[model samples]
Target: MEPPNILSSIPFKQSPLNPGELNLTHYCMSFLLSIPWNDISVTGFEYLAKKYRLDVFSDTSNPNEVLLSLAGKIILIDVIIPTHGTYRDIRIALAFADATGEQYKNTGAEEILLSAIHENNTTLLERNVALLAMLDRCSPSVQQSCFQYLETLKSTFSLIYTSRLNTQAFNDETEIIMSAEGKPLNDNDGNLGLQLAFWKHQDFLYTAKISMNELPSNSLPCALYGSNLVAETPLKTSGEVSWLPETTMTQIPATMELLFEDYHIVFPEFGVQSLLDFLQITDLDLSENFLPYKTLLNLPNQTTAGYPSMNKSHIIYLGGIDIPSRSVHRIPYSHPRQILGIFQYVRQYLTLQTIFENVKLSSTRITATASLRLNLIMKQYPVIHIQYQELNKLSNVDPVIANVSVLPNGIVQLNSIACGNTPINEDTALKIQKMLQKTLNIGLVLEFAIPKLFNNQ
Candidate 1:
């Protein structure tokens, strides 16, 4: 026969209250019921109570009897805590019945207790009192453990609260100040060694001069100028003064000036409308890949160069008109003249012509019958001989041979072209040779007769 399951033998019932409705008493009772009380030592009970923050003392109560009384007290505390709701009458009735070993039907006391606890906020002191009273009735070990746990909780709470208060105080009292200018100024005492002056022009340009008693010890003194505040380097510096200004457009009613080390600048009729207009343009929601032609056309004439004469209709043609379309299919082969025209168009923009030295061509039936000559310059060879022949309709083979000779002018020449049994005519060959000489700047092959003096020697 199998040994009995001790937990199964013990009387345990599920609480009628829902999870949200359960109170501290329900939790405590559940915990107590789940433990194998017979196996747990007196010391273990004390340790558990302390760990759980239950106010139970080890020395004050009988270990066995205290367990039952502790359960009763937990019930009482749960009922008494106003926040948890008053189940005092129900608890007392249960206690009386249990004392007399009389069986009583469930009166929904657990549900009522849970409802009261959740609805109210009991004071910490009151909660502590309830916990202490509950632990006082528990086993000696349980009481000891509970009391220790509660004490530790209280100490931790106090420490965290105090630290938060100190941090708030420090943040409130501390103040940090930094000078926007390079150095501090004492203008009140009339020791004004630094001075800034401004001059304005009709074209909305301003010039500023900064005069100082001595040169700056650290990095060069920087001045911020412009309606939108741009940093400007000094234009020219004399013995004790420097000019810090830039030739930039400004708007009417202009107050823009150079700002440095507490020195102030004032200009007459400076305008800020231009800067605001620029900022507004910058803030526009424009497409990343495409420009908005309509937005550009709507800009003020003064804001854009040649805006008055710019045709708005032309903008539509310009917008995305130049962008290549994905839907357009590529032409694999075109008329040889058309291909040559494109090559010539591209070649006009090319600074170097060495890229065409050894042009690789795939023979296709589409351009097989067409004969074309291409000029190219080779860096290694003075002359290159290229021969092309069609073995059959399927394949046209071409072999390239470079005949290089250094000329007297230190130039490489490619002066020969031999087409073996190909469709190239005499005119095509002569054009090819001439084109090569012109493109590569190769000199003609010179013929010289040997002198009689050299023959006699």
Candidate 2:
């Protein structure tokens, strides 16, 4: 008979996670759309405005004012379209409204509005294509209404809009800040420094600076100035983009070498040594076994503490490389609980690596073990799982058994360790125990989840 699968017998269930402040999906302000007053109608627009009802002034004298009805409550939305500026420069005002039509003062409304608008935009775009293909089959009036809605919606829709007088757009403010030459990139107090650059060619913004501390004393000063063409997308309408070197140009920091400037997208993987150096974590003497399984990188982004919004920001989490397949799986940092749980697993792996190296130096043979049990404690429930893997192979050696646990506050605790020969010395044993109890020293936490646990297998 074959040996039983350790994962098959364990019971696993979905548990609620306390994401804490790490969740960046929600925004402080509500979402808004800025279509012209004439476009709001009874027939062709129904698909776009499903549940919410729009009330436009019939007097034609007050075309700038529009009211939105949500769940029988009416909220005001101002429609202001500038005649002179480009389509990208137009600004509209929007905010969350409750059932009573007043402003929704509660947090988390932005997440709902963002989701709703994205869904609406997707449906409209999909239908617009189908209607265009069969335009010749329809009447002139239907064609006129359909074309009006599509054109107005495309030019007016935006996530970054002003609800208050002091509200500033992200890209515009970032451009001005980068252009100011004489000022230092970081404040003298050494707080988090974040710099963002929009790449027109790639259509995705790249983070220019994301360090928690100031640059090295010997490092060159930041040499970033605002680009001339940040949002010029005339070629995008035709669906045919011609490559231009000018579009790829970015304000490079003086610290980055030529190699880094070219392939900066993969900085999370290549910048590990820089992170380790900054943290002052030296003399690791890392082995192949430890490097493969214990490595992780935190994506660079601004802190969420006291920040107003995160609707436009992009977040990424990267974990260790799978040696066999050479595939790296991304860990979603949607919650603080998920991050802590993954880090707990990495702590266990590091402890195992230390034990193996100590044994090898002492000329003691250690037989590969089959099972290790780990407990992950959360606020609501405690998760128990078993790992089956061998550190190394050796002849005439004793098998080892280890049990580990992680407290809710992210402190790793070594429950027990057993070996037939007691090959681990007191000094080595004490060192391993400390490594188990250590907390992560990084400013932001990036973690690795047990593949089985995340997959709910």
Candidate 3:
């Protein structure tokens, strides 16, 4: 018994432009063209595009529906404009829904378009209707191109008349955000095909092509990949390690259950405290005006500070972006990834202790379960917790925090930085022992006290 391959049996071959296919493809292309080039001019996107071979997705000969299938490989996407177009009269790949980025210009269609969303802005609506009519005549991809070129043109000509500008809006205890910094300039060809050209410099690189016949079904096992999860943590890196050898990828596989489906927290301004927590860092000598909280909280797509495509993988609060709380419900995907979180509090604790043993105490409350997660991740490594000790006076020795681990009488060793600016002195050691007694319920009872060193040396 011969069963037919459904796609093969139903011919899409009569013409790549058969009227039915043509209508759907053209309509889809129109919508695609409406949104092109991100409002932010990060060229790494094009570098990414070329790697994935997405430039071909715009080939006039290909069917537009192919895009709906190709959406799986994309983890993050930004659109300057968005439309609620359908493919073949069906909601295709609804999981990859879009949120439009409000157009980034002002005093023109850009302002009108953004304003129309919340109010009865008729002039903007009329202008947009005309824009849509022209958009309908085109393919979704070409429509995207229209906006992409518009961005370039604005960059070039607008700069001829304008001066350098700084657009930072929010700077507080909350976050740090980068700026447009420079004007974007591109050719008439637009940036799509030109994107993702270089290797090695990009965060992640790959290419893809879609054919209905070759598509994987929704049931296939897939894992989400996120690189430059900068908001998760930064390489404060008193030292540096090679990250691009792709060595960071653990054998951990797709089973590493993602807590979120996508991450769209842009300009991803993390608070100083939040940043410190995620990186498991001691307090830093940070300057001010560093980060900005983004505009994605229940924010509408394509609207100022937000867009539609932020899907479930997108988070509400980046770790250390706020106070650590196990009870902070998913009301906002607003929790730090717990496993790496413990070191935040512990690191600061150790640093303060090492520098100011028996000094004035600075008490801060951190949740406990996060420490459990951190311990789980780092359990493989041997650690010496010089432990916590309260200060009776500013003159009391601070706890030590550094990376060197040694056995008794082995060699000179350093403490982990989660404790102090300097190594523990003898009296400071007693304080640490006392603090541990009050904090943890169990541990090995080492019959030794810290030995004095610096003064003797």
Candidate 4:
């Protein structure tokens, strides 16, 4: 007889996780995300939107945003925190993670992970096992966590990679901050010295600053400026990508080096590091394989505690080499950066000599913002999307794309798109509009079918 699929039999449905196991994971993980590491807090995520203008999502109601990824795939979600406090907010995310499992479900040490959490005093055996298992899978996020928790799981986990990400619009601001702050970048206060400071880069409107001091109070070797201590889980085929580099650049930080080292260490079969060491890719290669990193370079625009809006700023990285941060040793990539002087050498400047190809505007007259057109968007839903129509006209794709577009005002939107170039008869179009209207009329019933006993939005 074939061996039993223990995973499918035990932890999943057959032998359901007990109540206590569920609660232990949920509460513990939630507490972990909120207080992952104290030393490196560049900006509370809330500061990004109201003050710094780092737009990560269009919606304003639910703030805490998380990038859920498995291997090379990345999914961004603006989390709905069930509670107001940090510990509670993280718990909401933890619940979501438990529900979605995602990349965390594939781990070989499922029971081991659960046992570790249960072994701790913080864990409560009386809690529901189903809830704990659910949280372990999806929501609270599998990236950043407290020192004790992270250290405990280090043996099995690959590495948590936290890359400071933003759009190209914030490039100027990113360059300014990187330039101002050198190797020991956290120099805000005088003689005693401040951790970091925020500066506005006129070159780029969405400007901000971060320093690494608060993260490591004493013996901690790792210190980051607004960057979270993410845990990079191991994937079978493709590893998750926080951000992939677009072009070939040099004087890069220890971001790649650390990733290469840690990733290879965790999954030696992948053979990622030996190649770099043997071929000395660090010194010889300059390919388009590297782009995203958070070594005091680009800041996560709206994902943290302080940021405001999403898509408000584009980010550009100048140049930075990995250096030693004596204050924090855990981060081998924590080094001084060389944004100005080395940029010209490490970066290839754009030098397009060709002229424009061809373009012509249709003679069709553009309509003004008449009351009729404006009211069309405000009829049922509070938003209107313009890009889908443009893309449909240009690429000739599906015309019925639900592009959620919002006006200058901030309001929850629930509605439909206007009739576009889709070859739909008047009858079908009307039917969809009517059906959608009916669903909305049901008082907005969104649910998970079965009754789940946990926090709800």
> The CA-based lDDT of model 2 is what?
0.26
* Clash number by candidate, in order: 30, 0, 66, 72
**What tens-digit string does per-residue lDDT give for candidate 4 at 102-154?**
43231222333233233431222112222122222221234432211222223
RMSD of each: 37.9, 24.2, 24.6, 26.0
| Pairs of residues clashing in candidate 2 | none
Worst 10 residues of 4 by lDDT: 349-358
Candidate 3 lDDT over residue span 1-457, tens digit each: 1111111112222235463343555455545544433221123223334433333122123333223222212111222212233211222111111225322322343333334423434333333433322222221333233233223324332332122221133242111101111122222111111111111111321111000111122221222122322222222233111122223322211111111111111112122345334433332113322322212222221111111222101111111222111110001111112212222222222222222121111232321111100010111222333332222222454532223232211111334333345545556554544433323211111111222222311
TM match of model 1 to true structure: 0.14
Where is model 4 more than 4 Å wrong at Cα?
A: 1-27, 32-332, 338-457
Best candidate (score: lDDT):
2
Can you give the lDDT of residue 34 in candidate 2?
26
My TM-score estimates for the predictions, one after another, are: 0.14, 0.25, 0.17, 0.17
lDDT of each: 0.24, 0.26, 0.24, 0.22
> Candidate 1 local accuracy as lDDT?
0.24
Give Cα distance to truth, residue 96, candidate 2, Å. Answer: 9.0
lDDT of model 1 at position 425:
45
Candidate 3: 10-residue stretch with minimal lDDT: 368-377
